[model samples]
Target: MSNYQNFPPANEDGAASTQMFRAFVDEPAAQPPTAPNEGRRTGVIALSVIIALVVVAGVVYLAMK
Candidate 1:
């Protein structure tokens, strides 16, 4: 009538398998690497602003003429 009598014997191999599965599940994920050229974005933004200013200036000059 006892619950332990109904269960089968524990295997050593099953214990090792469970430990490996738990370690794999609990491990933290790796972060992605940062870009080496992040500073280049500022240069691109400055270039875009300069181009926009030149276009605006050209339009103003034509209107004045």
Candidate 2:
């Protein structure tokens, strides 16, 4: 039973536990300090925009014909 339930002893005041919980909850998720893929993301966005433009132009051309 003890092996299955190994855990740390609880704080007597409980304030520390509450503060730790609050700090953890309030903290923002960790993000990469630098966006190494930012350039790749921008390139993908540009390619998607270009593809969309080509599709729209093709539709317009078909409609005109």
State the RMSD for candidate 1. Answer: 6.4
RMSD of each: 6.4, 11.4
Output the number of the lDDT-best candidate: 2
- Candidate 1 per-residue lDDT, tens place, 1-65, comes to 75665443565553478779989999999899998788899889999999999999999999999
Stretches of candidate 1 exceeding 4 Å from the true structure: 1-33
Query: How much lDDT does each candidate structure score?
Result: 0.84, 0.86
Which pairs clash in the backbone of model 2?
none
Of the candidates shown, which would achieve the greatest TM-score relative to the real structure?
2
Q: Candidate 2, which segments miss by more than 4 Å at Cα?
A: 1-32
Task: Write candidate 2's Cα lDDT for 1-65 as tens digits.
Answer: 34686555664434478778889999999986998899999999999999999999999999999
Q: Which consecutive 10 residues in model 1 have the weakest lDDT in total? A: 6-15
Residue 48 error for model 1, in Å? 0.4
